[model samples]
Target: MLPPDFTLLQVVPELETGGAEQTTIDVARAVIDAGGKALVATRGGRMTARLEADGGRLAQMPVQSKNPLVMLGNAARLVDLIRNEGVSLVHARSRAPAFSALWAAQTTKTPFVATYHGVYKAGSGLKRWYNAVMTRGDLVIANSDYTRDHVLAEHHLDPDKVVAIPRGIDLDRFNPSWITPDRLSELRDSWGIAPDDPRTRFLLAGRLTRLKGHMTIIEAAARLKAQARNDFQILFVGDDQGRTGYGEELAKAVSDAGLADRISIVGHCDDMPAAYLLADIAILPTTVPESFGRAAVEPQAMGRPVIASNHGGTTETVAEGVTGWLVPPENAEAWAKAMERAIDIGAAKRTEMGLTGMNRTRQLYRVDAMCAATLAAYERVLDARRLTGKRP
Candidate 1:
């Protein structure tokens, strides 16, 4: 017999190389792997390749256009597509696309799902209403308990409607044992580091947004660089995402600190596992609470210690002394002090922490575990709909 014919549509603003975008691709692949029809609809971006490569169909839609008329047109287009393709459920990943998906789901009586991936702050009523779409999903997915609580506090959404499905990481891809020595050497060389260098490599991976706390990290690095007792390299691996000026400002800060030789911005790393393997430590210094810190978990899976700002999902992912350190958010001094602790811990202690982290991540945050939970949630949603004899 053929596999069950349930169609799932994932709507997003764009498919770029970020935590959320990567999850979209992974979830799409998971749906197909589970013998379902996986369809991704978006404005189109870098992530489309993985979606199509996973044997999922891509439906290009400018659901991200902010204009009222454009959103209405997108809604109509979505409605037609949903009807034509017999989409069983429509999932939206962002506000712009959520509006269109909401309209289409309402019109076609399909299940509407939304995943809240960030701690979105509302500036005004209009912005709050715009973000309300996320809470309106038939079955809302919160990337963390922190994110779930935010939804309840901000939108007054029902507790039952909001389900916590923490973001998943691919264990197989991130396994330290799987990372080849040649790959590590290649990445080290590409980053302009000598293979024989005794200096530890520290990485800060994220888009160069103000919220990422690049300046804060740079300040911390300067302190480390100035210390005569320490030797280390800092690699900032991510594109600026239209924040060229911010990137330049950060570069200037590094230059002014006289740490230019040890600090480099390596843009858009394609081989993240290799990059993580080369790192002695990973840092995430976000000013805002990350709904889930993928950077924290990925490197842990690679048996590299991670240090993150103490807030949001990192509270659960990074176990202070067990996995890595968690410093006060946006404090350069605190970050620098943590860096010193990391450096002082010695190789044997760091190795133990990395091993503990690897086991912890495998048990709790594996991609397969995430995918299974998601599908189980979908089943529950469908079952509830059947019982209620209601159509969204």
Candidate 2:
């Protein structure tokens, strides 16, 4: 049991719809359920209301600013908040906020934790130094084994201080049993998928950006179409994030390949569980390494087969021929062949694979497990602080 007065303050850029923000809300719910106060300091977004509903308080702050002067002011403000709120621990999820939270935690003599949520690329000394703040946590959390290895290779830290904890999904939300047929029909209809159509729906979900391999998937779709394998429909679901040029390029590519009818680029989806249920196979053809690909895990939780690039967090989350298939990154031909294989697997084998993935997800990637591990880390830091009699 947690101490009644124990409080944890998590800092992030915004309460938005992403893996980090979702984890922030999950941990906040865990802290509350454990009889402790949970506080989040972030610029508000769509998830702010949900966070509050889950018993987490929002302390609005511009911790997202990267300006040196603004960051210094943020550090001072965070220190004041820590002291006034009697915060027992400070946790940060992004680099900009981590700097301020790190300074405040040190100044207030409070335990600090940081979650490495991205595979931060640093091609220069200054960038490397900026990225080093994540490794400065009293206890550093890596979202995957690949991420932990990246941290160990890039940062000079005691290996024992770094822990790899994969991001978890809320099984209650992603469960296939809870999603009704109406929900599936609603998503399919929104995507213009005909009720009697027998074509397999291949879904690639993420921001409509180059790094997500939208071009690569488009190329793969072209390859499949050229092979006269037109029994599949490829769907790209995500916001363009105001990248009109890129969206236009994608549409032109589809037109050039004569696959405009076979491929559709749909915008942001509100119900992911239903979306997953509507997909025959989910794809994550990323060009760069992901820290922890929630797209890979969420679909699996919904009992859908996945086909992700053979790299990064997907390497750990996806099993070959069991949960899903992994193809070479950025290779259209390879992706096309994999898609063919998925189609050949037929409905029975696909159901078997989905069942395997569902079981694996339940055993390893549930949100409750992540919360337990995170709280355990916090307890370690708090225990040390108690023994040393540290105070602001």
Tens digit of per-residue lDDT, candidate 2, span 2-107:
6789899999999767899999999999999999999999988888999999988999989999999989999998999999999999999999999999999999
The 0-to-1 C-alpha lDDT of every candidate, in the order given, reads 0.86, 0.91
Regions of candidate 1 where Cα sits further than 4 Å from its true position: 1-3
| lDDT of candidate 1 over 214-322, digit per residue (tens) | 8887888888766764577889999987769988988889889888877898888889999988889999999989999999999999898899999999998999889
Give Cα distance to truth, residue 145, candidate 2, Å. Answer: 1.2
Colliding residue pairs in candidate 1? none
Clashing pairs in 2: none
Q: All candidates: CA RMSD in angstroms?
A: 1.8, 1.9
Name the regions of candidate 2 deviating beyond 4 angstroms.
389-392
